[model samples]
Target: MPRRTILIVEDERSLAEVLAYNLESEGHEVHVARDGRDGLSKARALLPDLIVLDLMLPVMDGLAVCRELRSDARTKGVRVLMLTAKGEEVDELVGFHMGADDYVTKPFKMKPLVARVRSLLRRPDAEEAEADKVSGAGLEVDRERHTATAGGEDLNLTPTEFRLLWTLMRQPGRPFSRHELMDASRGGDANALERTIDVHVRSLRQKLGDRAETVETVRGVGYRFNENAVAAD
Candidate 1:
């Protein structure tokens, strides 16, 4: 029951109202926006913990809003849960590539939707006793500072990306299944699709640059931090 703030950027008034009402009942503070433009504005202003965005909207579509959110430093770390009437696999991939943390197709059940929202809100707390720093493969991750650096350069990672890297690096040489990585990166509350992890990995690899090979795909399993690639410290 983390008391998190959420923004609902949905043009459908009835649907938005229903979501808001249910979310509020779960002890979350919720805000509503009628269109994509307004949604972006409020997102910057409020900097909510999570955003519930609809794909179809006036003024600005959700895709545009999502891209804007991810591009801006101020809102880049905020979690996004996309809602769409289209349930196609390609559409889901597009949303993930745009930095959405989760996705829900329209005509969804309230219970599962609320459950997904709860999952996004559950992040590791600041006081959690994780190793303050880890260094390997020319990458340095400091949990206390919530920062990562590659080859002495700072990495501007999204929250999900940071967690994914942290999880992998914590157990160098161990293969992590997509489902296991999903839970570690987003918390046990997360309802992330297996493919969603691939999107995050792609973004994370780009940031890793020359050290990208440190995160290796395990093929039939998932991914692992290649201990063999660790640079001599």
Candidate 2:
């Protein structure tokens, strides 16, 4: 793995130092910012491979930073992993809504954090490359263009929804358990309630409308996208 650069936006000096040290040990170039303002500045200047952001920060706050990053075309594709002490569902949902690629509660294990960082950074770029060469069931996903269209209609999906659809579309006939879908779509939080995936899938199906049946429920197994179904919209 090449040396990936990561920006750490955290208020606690000690915790930031510890995280930076661990990430540096894994051969990543780490930069630390104590507040959201500085963090956002460094992010713009450095364009780090990833950002480890804390929800609570002085001045701008992590949510603002995420919004700014997502809004800016230059940084829109940069990966973000929210690191916060808040373990509530609302916080997690808010982070996801603000475009966080992953969320981690504080007092977490270093190994898992590093692994997730590696996994996320590895994903988007490679997937984008592969998606350009792929098409399916009259539904075309152009990752390079960051667009997906089914039956000649564009699917206006949020980033998470797009990731979820991409996961299923990529696998086609494979039955992905709700737990597996949740992990793949929303980052692996084993404690994350199963209903979250259902909610997103429901929303996705609504967007698909008459083509919704293309995504099939496999009794007790979970959900699968059947390319053969080719529902008429």
Candidate 3:
């Protein structure tokens, strides 16, 4: 319920106005960008809490924007809610390795989109509450400061990936089920799909580089941080 900053990137003038109006009415400071390139610029400059990005854009596509943002250390952690032209586009975005936090199909209702925004904003609160430094092996995760690094390189993690890594790093060796991880990373969004956890884990691992092997998959169970290397220190 706190005031949040949100950015809306849509080429549709009417849709952008409606989104800005509704989000502002909810006590959120909202900004709008008419195209993908503009959105990327505003996003880096403003660093909003969440972004509602449309897939099809004029200057650059949404996926490229997402990639560019995720590649930047400053804007990588920002939460993104992708707006796609079709339901199937969601799969492409998720599986395409753009590292988007969440997705919504076009022709969506206002109320549900608002709820999604609220939910996305809440994703990091649980981690923030338990903020503390956890380090081992060649990796480090700082909750209070909200940073993660491996092998002396900054990991440009999204909000969900950061939460997921923190959850595992804080509790090494304990294999967490997909459902449990989904709840941890998503703040218990019951509508969230468990399969999405795999997608996130895959993306997280990809960013992890060499440390990727530390996040071991337990057959018939789930994933766990290899305590032997990163128990506590």
Candidate 4:
């Protein structure tokens, strides 16, 4: 495999060293930053292929770092994996909302962390990629660009929201159960609560405006995008 650069933003020096060592052993070039502000600066300058970010950091928090990275077009596409000692659903949600591509609680094994990083870097489904390349009614998804526009305006979405919209929009007529959507968008992590998907969907809908109706709720089933809606767009 090619040596991809990975930035590790962790306050714990010993833990950071261990992670950097393991990641380097896995053939990735690793860079370590002990605080969020410095991490953010390094991230912008280095533009690493991936970032392993801790939630709590000095000078700036991980959430802020994530937001800054996402807000900037240059670094928005860089994948992020949040590492934190906090295991609460809300904390995870906050990280996801701030643009984390994945969340792993601390006390995690290095192997799984590496696996998650690899998974995030892997190419998305070819079919989904094809579907997201164009616009649909009330929804316009551009997978390569990581953008979704509804009603001719860009929706300010977190990375997770963009992934969820891509998944649902690609299927169009297909109804995806919460579990299926979660798997498709959140890497099938059982630790990811169903409510997280719901929260993101609600946020997506709010930003979508008139296009919101296209995202149909199937009651007990889950949700589906309206095919006709995309055609109308």
* Tens-digit lDDT string for candidate 2 (1-233): 66566889999999988998898888776777799998887676455679999999999889999999999975888899999999999999999999999999988998999899889878757434553434566776664466888788999987657756766776678787776665455521235576788889988888877777878899998998887777443
Tens digits of lDDT, candidate 3, 31-126: 777889888876764556789999889999998999999999757878889887757854665624787788888788999999998898888644
- Name the 10 consecutive residues with the lowest summed lDDT in model 1: 123-132
Q: Stretches of candidate 2 above 4 Å error?
A: 126-233
Per residue, candidate 1 scores C-alpha lDDT tens digits across 2-55 of 456688999998998899899989976677889999898767645567899999
Residue-level lDDT of model 4, residues 64-109, one tens digit each, is 9999999997588888999999999999998899999999997999
List the candidate 3 regions with Cα displacement exceeding 4 Å. 89-96, 125-233
TM match of model 2 to true structure: 0.54
What ranking emerges by lDDT with the best candidate at the front?
A: 1, 2, 3, 4
Q: Which stretches of candidate 1 lie over 4 Å from their true place?
A: 125-233
The lowest-lDDT stretch of 10 consecutive residues in candidate 4 is: 123-132
Cα lDDT of all candidates, in order?
0.82, 0.79, 0.79, 0.78
Clashing pairs in 1: none
Model 2: ten consecutive residues of lowest lDDT? 182-191
lDDT, residue 171, candidate 3: 65
Show pairs that collide, candidate 4.
136-230, 137-229, 137-230
RMSD of 4: 15.4
